[model samples]
Target chain A: MLELGPIFRALLRNKIGAILIAVQIAFTMAIIVNAVFIIYDRSQQTKRPSGIDEANTFYINSSGFGDDFDIKGTITRDLEAIRALPGVIDAVQINAIPISGSGWSMGLQTEAGAEHDGQGVAVYMVDEHGIKALDLELLAGENFAKSDIRWRGPAGSKWPAKVIVTEAMAKRLFPELSYSEAVGKTVYINNDEPMIITGIIDKLQAPWVGWDNLDNAMLSPEKMEFQSTRYLIRTVPGMRDQLMKTVEELLAENKSRVIDGMRSIDYVRERSYRGNTAMIKILTTVIVTLTVVTSLGIVGLASFSVNRRKKQIGIRRALGATKASILRYFMVENFLISASGVVLGAALTIALNMLLVSALSIPPLDWFYIPAGMLVLCLVGQAAVFGPAKKATEIAPATATRTV
Target chain B: MLTMTNVKKVFRTDLVETHALRDFNLQVDEGEFVAVTGPSGSGKTTFLNIAGMLETFNEGTYQLDGEDVSHLNDNQRSKLRNEKIGFIFQSYNLIPDLSLFDNVDVPLRYRGFDAKERKKRIEESLDIVGLANRMKHLPSQLSGGQQQRVAIARALAGNPRFLLADEPTGNLDSAMAQSVMELLKEINKKGTTIVMVTHDPQLATQATRNIFVKDGQVSEINDVVAMHVANG
Candidate 1:
């Protein structure tokens, strides 16, 4: 039988230590739950697919410096040579790589005029071979034809009439229509320039992984006529590393151009999400450290309580308390304290989550984390108090008769 | 109601072996109030502890209410102790944080009585000890005599077959000690057996029988009286 009534009354009289430990537990729970939630949230974000064959693709930047360097000619020649290599599948000169953390964005509206509300979209400048070179699955509409490809000079301002948008971008632009139905729709870029949505790709992330509209992107059918360009190359399975070296060497053969910043999509992704990875590691350490410190605090308090009540425990033992009963007594007492702490912790968890949601604009915490944290902390408390409580049982029943 | 035959208790340390009890023998019938007196280190307390089942005896055949308890496990001993034995300590060992009622409720709780039955027993025992009205007061709020009375109430709450008290009135004044002695006599009159160990010969004279212990064995009354006179 549990002596809950007597133990509770006893705690009521001597509660300063229990209250301090309980408050410590409450604060630890609040921080741990929130930190775990943030870690989960960030890890999920880092796992989002960038809609490319990341394992078999890479990109390299080439900049020609002298007057004899042919920007357009060199790009065209380099594409032909790279595509014709043994392991190369397809290649395209892209303006920006997906999830690379830097790119161009523009506003597209359904109707004309600057006063009309528009949605933001990251812009990828690729030619007719963009779909195969980037491994994009065209969900609806047709791919761009060779004749549809346009060349834009450094001083050019004309917008392409045909553009392909990702399914997410199509949904944002025309929420009333399905992705397939939005294929032939016309959207106005730069407020008034008419651009028709020629196709819808299944999934593609924008250049900025941290953006709220990470999946909202459009592919314009254009090749740059500038001094610097990046070539996105996709190789056959198990051939990316070999092709990366070959392509870098081939591009380096051009004396007027410098080949630099050659990287695979995997490296780009790692660099992009480094902040999130660091945050996860730091929060995990904090949670572990807080749990250890809180457990130690519980051990300290329980050991002190047992030491102070040695004579009382002996008297109880002499009165007929079995070892198991004595063990249960301390366990139940710790449970009551932990239960109170977790109850307060639940409120604090939700409150902290609310503040984070308002301040950081992240989603509100999931409801299940509160209960899970409470149970874990309770188990930790019970485990921590076991050693001291067991020591209490070792006190001789004869201690009650000792005058000292 | 209680018997011990050739009980031996040896206290061994790294460098010393002290015999607390050797070839100890004692028997007390039901409803008898027996007082044991001895000088310091005479093993009087050790005998009380062994009799109460608080400490185990080596090389002994012990019977309490006709049950052989020499080979009982610790848990079995604890159950028998809880069900059949009551103890009062020299210091009036009431848990300081618990009120009179709650302190008295400790053994009954271990006895597995329900709340109503426990409450009834607690009130009745406290009434017997003349502290029922002060049941809600903490032990620290009471005087020394009142605390000892609370301890007695706790011992009587379970209605055990025997009470083992080690110097029950050792910490009280003369008036309080006499009052507690009268209470014990009244309890003995009600047919509960009691075995008390004390150093006070005046207190020992009031028991139905008095036994003196010297050098871990019970000695004669004349020898204890002569030793008492010599010490004085």
Candidate 2:
């Protein structure tokens, strides 16, 4: 009601100051929004699923038992021993588990032609019953082979002749191909020899979450060497601690590997969370520091504009204008600066988001953030105006009357 | 109406004390055109500042339109000044960043008038100054005389009880100054009490009454007698 109302005109008056404010706001917003999304994703990764209970599971790095031991024999013997132990519910030997997100990558060049630049897919290898053990769903086709599986290739650097593909990979590699077409397709994976796709499994968990999932390739145990390191053991209620202690006792002679240093799948997943959390904190501190600096810059500029207008303000004051009216005038000017900065910053942020997605290969700017980002900028701009507006009011009308 | 009786204003710094106004007294009845003339350091501006409630005096009994202004706080003083006083300055002091209409509207905004009322007041004020068609033009686009007229319009828009002019025509050429002098005379005849401080002897004599300040106190001399007294 004093001259013009608060919102619209306030931001329209000060152009550069408003842009600086919005840039700061957008900077802070980019970090804050990115941080929140990262946290949410990490939480989703950490959330416990119903099938294989992580809390009641016992895992061991079997390769830690010795440098040159038969991993299969050791795994078979330990699993039996673990199952026989008190409170141990189930023991299974698995070649590789996927939930830790680390999947073994191999080449996938569409046997037709390797045309494009090196874009390769990964293939995961696991022994028999690993799927049932991890409680993963097989969307199409059967699991890996039940008998001995082997691939005789160059330097023996190969997995089994039978494989499984995740649904995402199935879509990418096959697309319109039926399960039966996919089952017999010679997929070039670990062995340099084409292996028949025995099953199609929806991606459960991998070393990374991705749509392409280059490591979406799967290998059965018949193709592996006689050794493996990791073991995923599921147990019944309340027997988790006892089961872990027994595994430690078994590896106690070799000691160091299984001591307090062994990392579980849960630890690995949380490591990713910690990684993103650090990112959030760093980016947030940077954006906040810059926002403070920008706000100070805007307020400084606004103060100058007000000081220069002192005589005019004094004239207005003498002409029956109240201090509140003068205060609103300066504040509205600041709002203009803020609003302009916000709009430009919004566009700038969107442009920056494009670079973030294209160059850095991070996610694009989510549309939901624009309005929220602007709101933050508007608030910051208003704050910048506060000191100067009050100063403008303190100017006396008699100041203009002086022959300056 | 404006009255000042035995007002004293002292300025002090660490160890130096200077008296700007000592035993200053003057009175302006309704509808009087009064000119205050003085040499530098004679305290004419200080008297105006005190009378306009722009500066505080160390000791005084001062009243404006029947209210005691000598003891008013900053806000109260501001309220009194806004409600009762209008000003025309030598420099015009028009807002460089605002248009003519907006410049006139600035004071009315302080008075908290609605848009329709403020617009009407602004147009009428500009019309009185013969610049109604040029309301959208900036002060920079106007000549000094025109800008000064806008300043007058600014003061007039508020419709204050009294008008204060500090060297209002000092910046204008002689021909423009006479026109402005005529404008002031006409405004005075319309019943707006005007207190003008001028250095021009001719302009000072044009007022109905004149006061000359010497050193730190008021000195009385006839309009013609004052010039000869200063010149001699």
Candidate 3:
């Protein structure tokens, strides 16, 4: 039989130790729940796909230094050499690599005026081979033909007449139309320069992983005539590392240019999300440490309670309480304390989560974490109290008759 | 009814094995009030503990109400003790945190009685001890004599057939002692078998039978009060 009423009243009379342990449990639950949620959120962020072929792809930069570096002719020759390699799938000279933390952005509007609001998008300058080199699926329209490619000088201001967009950017630009229907639609960049949506790709991420519109991007068919150029290359399976070394050595052979910033997509992704990984590790440590401290607090309180009530326990045993009953008594007593702690902890968890949402701009926590935390903390309390309660059962009933 | 034959209890340590009881024997019929008196280190408490099943004897054949309890497990012994025996300690042994009603309800809870039945028995027992009106008062709020009465009420609430008391009035003044003695006598008159262990010879004379314990053995005596007076 459970002695809940008697145990509660007893706790009320002696509230100091019980209250301290309860508060410890409450604080521990609050911190642990929120910390676990944060860790999970960070892990999910790190696990999200960047919508690129990260495993078999890499990128390198070529910054020509001499006066007559032949930027356009050199880019053409470099593309031909890379594509003609044995294991090379495709290659393109792009203005920026996706998820590489450096890129260009522009806003587009359906209406041709500054008075209308526009959606933001990351811009990638590439030639006809952009989709194939980046391993993208042309979901809604045909890929760019070679005749559509154009060349612009360093200070050129002319805009391309046609552009291809990711499905995410297409949806944002034309929410009322399906992505396939939006393929031939016209949108204006730079407030009035009209650009037609020539095609739509299935998925692609922005260069900045932390952007709210991470998947909003567009590919413009243009070759750059500048002092530096970046080349994106995709190799067949198990050929990327050998190709990366070969390409770096080949680019370095030309004395007019320096080969630097040669990195794989995997390395780029890791460097991009390093902060989130560190946060997850730190929060996991915090959760574990807090749970251990709270469990120890429960054990300390229960052990002291048992030592103080040795005589009472003996009296209960003499009054015909079995060892099981004595064990039940203490266990049930600790349960009551744990129940109170979890109740208070629920409120504290929500309050802390609210503060985090407002201060850190994180999304609101899912509702189930509160109850899950409560159940876990209660189990911890019960397990921690078991050893002391068992020791209490070993007290002899003859202790009741002993004067000292 | 209770009987013990050649009961042997020894306390052992690393270097010593002291005999607390050796070849002790006793018998008490139904409806008898027996007082056991002895000096310090005489094993009176040890014998009472064994009879109450609070301690197991090393070698003995004991029977309580026709059941051989020598080989009972701890759980079985607890059940038998709950169903058959009640104990009153010298210190009253009331859980100080609980009210009089809750203290009285403890033993009945172990007996697995329903709440309504337990309530009825607790009220009736406390009324017998004249503490029913103060059932909600904590034990610390009561006097030593009143606390002992609560202990007696706790014992009686379970409706056991046998009662074992160790120095029931040891902490009381003479007036309170006499009052408790009269209460014990009244309980005995109602056909409850009781065995009381005490150092007070005057109190022992109040029982229908007196047995003196010396050096772990017993001898029946009829004039304990006179013997105590003569020794003084």
Q: Pick the candidate with the highest DockQ.
A: 3
Query: Which residue pairs in model 1 clash with each other?
Result: none
DockQ comparisons of all candidates to the true complex:
0.79, 0.37, 0.81
Q: How accurate is candidate 2 locally (lDDT)?
A: 0.69
- Ranking under lDDT, best-scoring first? 1, 3, 2
Model 1 C-alpha lDDT per residue in residues A273-367, reported as the tens digit of each score: 99999999999999999999999999999999999989988888899998899899999999989988999989998998999999988789899
Residues B83-169, candidate 1: write the lDDT tens digits: 888898889999999999999999999899999999999999999999999999999999999999999999999998989999999
Worst 10 residues of 1 chain B by lDDT: B220-229
Off by over 4 Å in 3: B221-232
Write the residue-wise lDDT of candidate 2 on A1-404 in tens digits. Answer: 44554234334444454565556655655555554444445455445342345566656764433566554455556656766777665555544444555555555544634443322455444556566555566877787665744433225665556777666566567768864567667666532556677777655545554434533545455433344455666667676667677767876554323444344445655564565657666766766676688678768887887776777677766665567767877777666656666676677767766766787666665677777777776777778778888988988767877766
- Which structure is stronger by TM-score: 1 or 2? 1
True-vs-predicted CA distance for residue B70, candidate 2, Å: 4.0
Give the per-residue lDDT of model 3 (tens digit) for A1-404.
89888889988989888888888888899999999898888888888887778999999999998788899899999999999998999999998888889999999889999998888999999888999899899998888889888997999977899999999999999899999999889999999899999999988888998898989999998999988889999999999999999998888888889986889999999999998888888898888888888888888888999999999998888899999999999899889889899999999999999999999977888999999999999999999999999999999988888998
**TM-score-based ranking:** 1, 3, 2
